[model samples]
Target: MKTELDYLAELAGHGRISRRAFLGRAAALGVSAAMMPALAGKAFAQTAVKGGIIKAGLQGGESTNSLDPALNLSQVTFSFGKLWGEYL
Candidate 1:
């Protein structure tokens, strides 16, 4: 199915899954091996840059706003700050 092909392509595109794995899955799904390269290219083209700041411009924050775990003021800030911390 196209969806399965797309999923495999996406994993390969992000380098989370190997090309061999993608091809194997694709074949098992009845996709032709000759189509692998095109699928790979499409997947790679849609991939985002590997690393960068994930910015969330949360309004209503003041200079007093703190990212400290003990001082998280709101759920949005807490979730965003948690994610940003993980990106480091």
Candidate 2:
């Protein structure tokens, strides 16, 4: 998943940054967090609030939140640690 950032960061030699790491940094830089909403509003600029539920099959998933939940599940379940693709 070589995203726009992978190229940009690679140009800057930002090292091997995973998507999550890139997102965390971008949020810190106000890229996705602050700008995405604004861009969504400006780009779409509509009142239609389209919405849908994302049901992740929790049968086997990964959690990155806290160990409390991991304690009750496998370390390598379906690994719902994060998202990608359109949902991302």
Candidate 3:
């Protein structure tokens, strides 16, 4: 017979269940209580941290290239510089 944990795991795999509901059901079924916070913590941990500066170094621009936007010859460098320049 499949257990509640198995059902919960299936639901989780399908993205049809929330972490809180799954953990609550698991705990009700006498599953390890420790796993509740651990799983929740892991779920929260997977989230990305917000508001940080991102720097990228792209290679392609030649010495002749100027910081002037009109003189941009390399599309890659031009876009890269333009993107980072917005944050400055």
Q: Which candidate's lDDT is highest?
A: 1
TM-score for each model: 0.45, 0.25, 0.39
lDDT of 1 by residue, 41-83 (tens): 8554443456775777766666776777788877766876788
lDDT of 3 by residue, 22-87 (tens): 777877777688765644444333544556775766677576766677777788668766875674
Candidate 3's clash total is 0
Candidate 2 lDDT, 1-88, residue by residue in tens: 3365445355334345544564566565557565534322332233544565657655544444343434445534324333212442
What's the residue-level lDDT of 62 in candidate 3? Answer: 71
All-Cα superposition RMSD per candidate = 9.8, 14.8, 11.1
Least accurate 10 contiguous residues by lDDT in model 3: 38-47
The Cα RMSD in angstroms, rounded to one decimal, for candidate 2 relative to the true structure is 14.8
Better of 1 and 3 by TM-score: 1
Off by more than 4 A, model 3 = 35-49, 52-88
What TM-score does prediction 2 earn? 0.25
Model 3 Cα displacement at 27 (Å)?
0.8
